[model samples]
Target: MRVAFVSFETVHHRESETNRRLQTILELLSEQGHDVHVCCAQFWDGERSTIKRTGISYHRASAGLEAPTSFLARVPFVLAKLGPDVVHASVRPPKQALAARWGGMLARAPTILEWYGDGGITNDWWTRRAARWADWIVVPSELVETWVRELGVDEATVEVVPNPIDVDRIDGVSPGDSVDVVYARRLDADANLESLFLALAELRTRDWRAVIVGDGPEREAYEQLAGELRIDDRVTFAGACSLEERLAIYRGAHVFAQTAEHCVFPTEMLWALAAGCVGIVEYHADSSAHELVEGWDRGFRTTSEEELVDAILEAGGLARRDTDDRFASYDAGAVRDRYLTIYRTLQDSSSLV
Candidate 1:
C-alpha cells in the first residue's frame, strides 16, 4: 500500500505524543515494505523539498513550521500529487484534516484521521467539521471515541486503535535492580504524583522502595513534595529514562502506579503492565488510564490515597514477573495489521464507489 500521512509538523520539529505515534505508524508501514510518505512543513536543512529517511519519504507541504496558513493551504496539493492509495492524517490543526480529506478526494484516495485528542484545536465547530469530513477517525481509546461521537460523527465512522508497543524489544531487556513501586510519566501539572506520594507516606513504617521515572518542569516541586512527605530517600526520582531503562525499572518493580489527572491513553501504564508490574491505577474523571486494567486480575483501580495504599499492599502478594504475555496483542505488528485492515477496507469501499 502507498500510504501518505498529512501532518503540519513532524516529530523532528517537536516531540509530542501525536507526532511520535504518527512516526511509529509510518516506520512500521515502511518496515513492512509498503510505500510510505509524509507531507509536512520541511524539517530538513536545504533547498530540497523532499527527503528519504529510514525507507520513508517526507515531502514538504510548506516552507517551514511557522506558517500554519501556508501548511494548511498546500497539504491537499502535496497529497494529491503524491497520489497514495490511502491518506492518513493527524488531527491537530483541524483545518489540515479538512485539507487532507480534500486531498484524498482529489487523489481518489480515502482519508483516515488519527485523533489522539491530546493537543489540537478544541473548538467544537472545527472539530465536529473535521470529524464529519474524514473517511474514518482512529482514536487511541474508547474515552476518545466517546468524544468524537459527541461531535455527531456516526459511531461506525470511529474506531479505537491503541498506541502500539514493541513487545519483542521489551522481552529482550533484562530487569534492573528491584524496587517495591514504580511510577512513570512526565512530572508536569497533570503528573498527580502527590496521591502516590501520600500513599507511600502512609506506609512509611514498611520497608519498600519506589522510583519515579520522568522529568519536566514540575520535577523540582515533586521532588520537594517527596522530601516534605519524608519519603524522598526511599523514592528515587530517576528523572527521564530511556525505553530500556524504563522497561528494566518496570520489570524490576512489583507495582506500577497510574495517578495522572488526565490521559488520552495511559501509554506508560501499558508498558509497565506488559513488563509484568502489578498495575495500580488511581481513577480520575478525565483520564482513561483505568481502562487498561478494568477487568484484568493483575490490576487494581483506586479512587483515593487510602485505596491507593491498599492496592499497593495487595499487589505485593502477586508473584513478581519479568514479562506478561497478555499484552502481546498490543505488539507493533498487531497494530500495523489493524491499520492495514482499515486501509484495505477503505480502499475496497472506494473502488465500489
Candidate 2:
C-alpha cells in the first residue's frame, strides 16, 4: 500500500511533536513495506528535496512558505502527482483541513485527519468542518475524543490512538540512587515553571537536585526565582538537547515533575514513565494530566504549590518499580502493528467501495 503523509512541517523541517509524530508514522509504515511519501514544508538548511532518513522517504516544498497559502495552493499538486493509496493530513485545525479535503477530492483517496489537541471548548468552526470532511479522525487521548464528539463527528469515525514513542530508547538504564528531579518542557509563561521553582525551593533542605531542560522566554525569570530562593546552585538548567541527550537525562533522573497549566497531552510525562522515573504532575481537573494520573496510579498529582512540594517529597520516598512492562504497549513495534491494522482495515473498506 502507498501512503502519503501531508504534514506541512515536521522534524525534518522543525523540531516539534507534530513533526516527530509525522516522521514516526512514516517510518513505521515504510518498515511494514508500504510506500510512504512525506510531503513537508521546507527548511532553510537544505532539506527541500527528497531525502531518506530512517527507512522513510520525505519530500519538501520551498522554505518560509506560509501554512495557509501553501496548503491550499501547493498540496493539491503533490497529491495529484503522487497518487497514494491513502492521504493522511495530520492536525488540520484551520486552512490545512480545507486543503486536505480538496486534495482528497482531487485524488479520489480516503483521508485520515489526525488531531492531538483538545476540542469542544474552543469555538473554531473551520476545524469542525474539517472533522466532518475526514474519512477518519485520530486523537492521542480520550480527552481529545470527548472534544471531537462535541464537534458532532460520528462516534464511528473517531479513533483513540496513543502517541507513539520509541520505548526502547527510554528503556534499560538503571535509575540513580540519589533523588534527581527532572522537568523537560519549554520554559514559557504557560508552562508554569515558577510553581516548580517554588516547589524546588521548598525542597532545598531535602536530599534532591532539580534539573530543568529546554528553554524559552521565562528562563531568566525562573533563574531569578531559583537565585532568590538560594537553590540556584542545586538546580541545573540543561536547555534544549538532542533526542539522545534528553533520553539520557530521563534515564539518569529518579523523578520527573511538570506543572503545565493546561496541556492536551503530556508527552514528556509518558517518556519519563517509560524511562523508569517516578512521575509527578501539577494538573487541575479539566487537564489531560488528570486522565493520565487517574489511569496510572504510579504518578503523584497535585494542583497547588504546596501540594506539588508534598508530591515531590513523596516521590523521593516512593520505591522505583519496573515500568518497562507497563509502557511496552507504546513501543514502536507494538504501535506499528496497531497502525498496520488500521491501514489494512482502510484498505479493506476501499476494496469494498
Candidate 3:
C-alpha cells in the first residue's frame, strides 16, 4: 500500500512523544513493505524544505508558526508532489486533519485523521466539519474517543488506536547504588511536580535522591520549592537531556514517577515502565495513565502526598521482582503488529465508502 503520513509536526524535526510515535509508525509501515511518505513542516535544517530518511520520504513546507493564518496554502503543493494512494494524517485534531481532508479531496485519495489527545479544539467548527469530511478518524485512547464522539462524530467513524512506544529502543541498565528516583517531563504546573517535590520531602528519612529532568515555565518556581523544603541537596535539577540521555536516566533510576494533573496519553510513563523502573503515577480526576501499569505488576498509582511518599518508600526498599515478565507485552515487535492489523484492515476496506 502507498501511504502518506501528514502531520503538523515531525519527530525528526522535534523530539516529542508525538514525533516518536510518528517515527515508530512510519518505520513499522516501511518494514511491512508499505511505501510510506511523511509530510510536515520541517525544522530539522532550519531552511531545507525536504529530506528523506530510512525508507520513508519527508516533505517540509512552511513552519506551523510561520503560516498559522494560512495553514492549508501549502497542502495542495505537498499532495501534488507525493500522489499518495491513501493519506494518513497524524494530528491532534480539527485543523491539521481538516487541512489533510481538503488536500486529500483535491488529490482524490482517502484520508485518515489520527488524534492523540482530547479537550483541545474538539468543538471548533473546523474540527467538526473536517471530522465529517475524513474517510475515518483514529484516536490513541478510549478517553480521546469519548471526547471526539462528543464533537459529533459517529461512533463507527472513530477507531481506538494507541500511540506506541519503541520498547526495544530502551535498554535497562543498573540504576547504580545512588538510590535515585527520576521524573522527566516539561516542568509545568499541570505536570504536578509540586506534589512530587512535597512527597519527596516527606520521605527525607530515607537516603534516596531525585533527578528532575526537563525545563519549562515552572522551572524556577519548582527549584525554589525544593529549596524551601530543605531537600535541595538530595535533588538535582538536570534540566532537559537528549533522547539518549533520558533513556539512560530511565535505566539508571530505581523508580519513575509521573505526577501530571491531567494527561491524554503519557508516553513517557510507558518508556519508564519499559525501562524496568517501578512506575508510579500521581492521580488526578482526568488521568488514565495508571492503566499502563495494569498488568505490568511493576508499579502503582497514588492520589496524594502521603500516598506518593509511602509508595516511594516501599518501592525503594522492596525486593526488585523479575521485571522481564512485566514488559513482555510492550515489546516493539508486538506493538508494530498492532499497527499492521489496523493498516491491513484499512487497506482491505473500500476507499472513502
Rank by lDDT, highest first.
1, 2, 3
Please give, for residues 1-353, the per-residue lDDT of candidate 1 as tens digits: 89999999889999988888899999999999999999999989999989999999999888897888998888889888889999999989888999999999999999999999885236578778999999989999988888888788899989999998999988899999999999999999999999999999999999999999999999999889989999999999899889999999998999999999989899898999999999999998778888899899999999988899899989999999989999998899999999999999999999999
Model 3 misplaced regions, further than 4 Å: 8-20, 31-33, 39-51, 59-83, 92-96, 102-109, 172-180, 321-325, 351-353
Could you give the candidate ranking by TM-score, starting with the highest? 1, 2, 3
- TM-scores, all models, native as reference: 0.97, 0.84, 0.81
Superposition-based RMSD of candidate 3 using all C-alpha atoms, in angstroms? 3.8
Cα lDDT tens digits, model 2, 154-200, are 99988877776787666544443343788888888677888888888
Q: What would you estimate as the lDDT of candidate 3?
A: 0.73
Of candidates 2 and 1, the better by lDDT: 1
Candidate 2's displacement at residue 225, Å, is 0.5
Residue pairs clashing, model 1: none
lDDT of 3 by residue, 59-98 (tens): 7656654664354567656876677777888665357777
For model 2, the run of ten residues with the poorest summed lDDT: 170-179
Q: How many steric overlaps does candidate 2 have? A: 2
> Which candidate has the top score in TM-score?
1
